[model samples]
Target: MRGMTDLGPLSLSPVMKPADPPGEPLPGIIKTKVFKEEDYINMPWKNGLGGTKQIAIHPHTADFETEEFIWRLALSEVRDSCSFSVFPGYDIALLLLPEDERDGSASVKNTVHLRRGSLTSPVALHHNDQATAVPLRPLTPYTYSGEWPTSCKIRTGPMRHLTFIANRELTRVTATLETICLHGLHDDGECSDSDEAVHKAPGEVNGTKKDATGNGNGTALPLGDECKNPMNGNVNKLLIGNYSIVYVVSGAVRVTIEGTLEPHTVLAGQTLVCERDDDSSPTDLAMTPLRKDGRAFEKESEHQDATVLIIQVNILRPERRRHSSLSDVSSFSQARPRGRSGSIIVYDDQPLPPLAGIDGDTAASSAARAVAGPSSPTSTIPMRSWDSARHYKPPVFSSRFKNESEVPPAVVRDQLIIDEFPVGAISTVWINMVKQGLSEWLRIPVIVARGKEEGPVVGITAVVHGNELNGVPCIHRVISDIDVSTLKGTVVAVPCINVPGYLRYTREFSDGKDLNRMFPGSPTGTASQIYAYNIMEKVVGHFNYLIDLHTASFGRVNSYYVRSDMNDAASAAMAKLQQPQVILHNSGQDGALRSAAMTRNIKAITVEIGNPQQLQNQYVQWSYQGVMRILSWLNMFQLDPADLAPAAGPPSSTILCSKGYWIYTKTGGVLEVYPSVNTVVRKGDLIARIKNIFGNIVDEVYAPGSGVTIGRSSNPVAMAGDRVLHMGVIKREGEVLAREAKENY
Candidate 1:
């Protein structure tokens, strides 16, 4: 009964007391209340599968038995395979909480299965089913309709999750769950007076300054001069919807709403609820640390780094009732089958319904469409069984080609195909290139591999610069070794996108243009432009995710690293999963393939392997392992024991640099690089020294800033203003780096 006090029904008195009219200086004040961990209400699930710790419910005093509440927020734990309680008229959003282990080594095996209509039916045939055989990392939230009798199976042990449920007809809910690490906090019991002084006022320490809009970088800060008072701490503005809730997973803090001067101290594992004011204005609130004898505890030891989960529930217009005929019900029932083993099964003879339109589009043209949109497409494609190694036949093409119209059609099977390749098979296609004369023609080699099951379409292109040969064999091995029967998606690989450059052992195409710089190319442009246009339209545009592999150009060597825009959550997540030795947080330059793909909303990343022109076996292996990790992370394929690299320790520590630069030589000479790739260097550290033909030292290059070497020029010869070393400046501290680096390929 400690935290279980009944606050009675929410009051509208505060908003009704306001005098401000529309467009006035001030709107109505919001009513906010704090609910501590001790006050949480424990309730049994209606289905008896598990129990939930109720944080707050609408109508204020509504209990679990109260059937008319508009929205509800709670935390639940699943220990075994149990059916979820069915709420026929509600929609639910669930987010899996990260485990306590910081190294991400904890074992977590949880599987979610969903079925529509009845609880008596098996839990198979759910489109959104996901199994986490490996540890479950914090991912984007998963949402489903409450009409479905969803269930969870704990393959290894128990799992905890935060959930938001709302009435589908009367309310709409949007939830985003992210984990932010607060650095510079000490874990020890010692605290300094200076730390407490810094916490007395908001935006006073550790780059916490707020802009004119009351926003501090990505952190939301309190608005106006109201935050200047030490007693008030810092105030933050909240535009409350029908209801708003903020829950603390770790650490402690204080909160105060506009109507009251007294602040409420909310510790870790506590929840705060803010009810919408009667008037239609945003809310004002302030937050600070729990104070003891008028002094704030600022040390991280007193308040560990916190991860807060924010949820918003809004009231929307009621959904129109749909009248379904008996035939409609029967057709849907055919797709849902009840099995004796409590596993849902789909019949082979049942015809699949068309994919529901995403964003109101009636139909999707390709597999990529299913992933980019909100809905999954219905596929009639049956799973095929085939021997990938023995039966695979690389497609052959005739050299004599008249025009683009003469290109052959892709081989299709099981509703899945990639340009001349059938499902569960690997084949090659000869993409027509420019001709030297009327009789002689040129073509680029394209490898296409289609998986047996229906999933997203992923495009992988390597050797775009022609001279980058490390990726060519890596692509071949990936395509040849995949067990098509287990794959859930399609794989399209282009071993050599620039055939002319590869044949000529150069980085640019025959027209002396960088192929990578000409993306979504214009059809009426130059030859390279036309080629780029064809690939973007016929290939890259249809991909949900793209991985463009490359190596350091001719004279340079690079550490096994990833170049990605860290600002993007999705791209950053994918890059972290690869566990590379290093990562460059770069917003790609203009016209780059990665940049072009992003404009079209396709998630893409560029991977830098070893040196160019030669296929280093070690780098090839590393590249292969990295790609497998990506595929596994996406749930496109299961990780095979043979394909698994040696048991990895904690991921290699990652250093994120917002800005990076290349050190250029001031005088022409023969260059000698002193440090290897991935070596950390400080300003004035010896990086390289240039010598003239007579063996006399010409100039010595020193590190310009404290950073790690990502790439360096390998060729001995150098010219004035020529880049010799590329370094990334380290600015953030306490950021987790992978503990150990993976073996270099």
Candidate 2:
């Protein structure tokens, strides 16, 4: 035991342990040493390809600071640049790494940022081919590269980086390997280029881009000799043919075959390759680097860009290689005539490795068909292909409202209980409440307002359509101004109807069903229908008089009017409450709550005010003024109606028609209406014309009989048989004519 020092107190010096061991370095070589700002050569390579700078590093150079190659331009700001290697006798693996974090290797046709240390497979190619090293932004769009094939038969897309194997000794270059650290939950495990990458070609134009100038054919070249140069006893042996395999590597990649390179996504640690050989079945091979490159590379760039490593390996028979070099093996080459169609087969000369079968190495070659899925015969069946589909579960609907008391009451004069309907009636009633960031568990307050004193129940509703928000605030203003303290009756103000649609700020509900048309709906119907039913049976049923509020749909403007069933006592009573510019005495069709209310001897009138999708001060004011007038009439509020006539609502001509004739267009086209609503037309009158976009007449819509035009199409566009106009015949006109003839007698 150590003894303590003398003095009041003594502190021990803290001993430091060595920093946690540096992360285990990745498994492969970093060919291009993590570049320095000085490593980028300012000198340009001027060829027929134009002036381009280059940075060439010999194989197996060991000076690496990071796994990623970081190069910066000397310009004021960095411009996007591409790096490539011209391997005359062998294929080199190259990845397009962008410093921009927004770039993604997975994205098609757009720049996509990727996580650090992501990599793609080795891109293979023929000898002496100048392939693209990378892609850039607005300046060097993927489309600007002349190497990218353009097809009128297909939609154009961005060009991608190319990795190719040269024509010589079938060199096998694993992608510039990178190690990715797993974070969050996106842990699929580390991946690297599989043997499949070397044999696969890029994607074909998606039928949208057809190469009329390029030859669509396949040719087979024989390997008379094999390259004996070996870094290790284990060397990649690729059979001659069009092979489909996922190049397990990083970043973006492309495979060019028969002159067209198809784009593919190469993810880090995982293989992404396709094997579809023009000859025989696609072959899958393992990508193993027998040679050691001492250069140290960053797993990711300092800027956090991704990297990719690719390999192309060719195998030759032992007998063929004895007489000549690997390039001289032309005896096995066979050139098919021009326009050769379909696939060709190249037999494998060597035995498969024992581990290859179990490791699913052959699966990569089979995976080629997986790209097109079951539709392509070349695809191998996926492991899950035979599995049964899991059962689907319906969405569970929960109610936000707990109970009756939790229901909020939009109280008016602090007494009348204007209750909204059940919460389950609308699927999205709580959507607006959610956007307001209200608790899903908390019930919303009912919009109805009431008077302090009890009397005849009078319900005022506005904005049956959600887009008509103007009516809601207008009714709110009207209810607030009412002095219900002196009221002789109960005034229930429902400031909003079609609440779901209102939340969406649209005229139609979430189901695209109009809440207005779904009157007296079934209890088991959809949300919109259920809402209508609940309001009619629960809310409307409580009142002796009902005023349904509404507004024109978007793109429509109309004069203020009141719709009431003629010859009905309640309808007549309610019609007197609206001081509208036009009081239309109309009969209700089936499913209308007003008609149902008429059956119950309850007064109900639907008031149309303002336009859809927008609110107007004048309309709101008019609505407020009209509501106040009605309140005054009922003695709920005391107010002097000077400008507004105190006498009933108004004296207006009653237009009657047993049947309304609807004029429909015979063909689909644009409709041009000459007469507006309220225009009197005779039978066979040209009410409208339909013409195609080219201005050629398609059809003419004519009036069926003498009548007044009451409605016309609001939308200029129309389909065949679409109703263009409606004509209301005046039976009274016939009566007047007959009466004048009788007076002559």
Best by TM-score: 1
lDDT top scorer = 1
How much is the lDDT of residue 661 in candidate 2? 50
Where model 2 places Cα greater than 4 Å from the true spot, the runs are 1-449, 554-557, 576-581, 617-625, 642-662, 731-745
Q: Write the per-residue lDDT of candidate 1 for residues 120-183, one digit (tens) a residue.
A: 3211213224432222223235566665644353443555676666666666555433222222
lDDT by residue (1-745, candidate 2, tens digit) is 0111111111000011112233321222111112222433333211111122222211112111111111111111111111122222232222333333323444332433333333431212222233433323221101122122211110122223322322233222222232221110011322213222211122112321111112111221111123222111111223332212222223322222222232222333223322221223333232222101211122212111133332222222334323112112123232222211211221121133232221233555456435434444565764323222235643221111001011121112212233332211110122121122244321122333334455576777766677876677666555444433344556666666566677888878668987677887778887677667666765667778777777767644444556666456656555655655545556665555665665566677777665567665555656566667666666666764542443223324434443345667788888887766555689888888888999998788777789765555767788887767656556564443221110000
Task: For model 1, give the 10-residue run with minimal summed lDDT.
Answer: 398-407
**How well does candidate 2 match the true structure in TM-score terms?**
0.38
Listed in order, each prediction's TM-score against the native is 0.43, 0.38
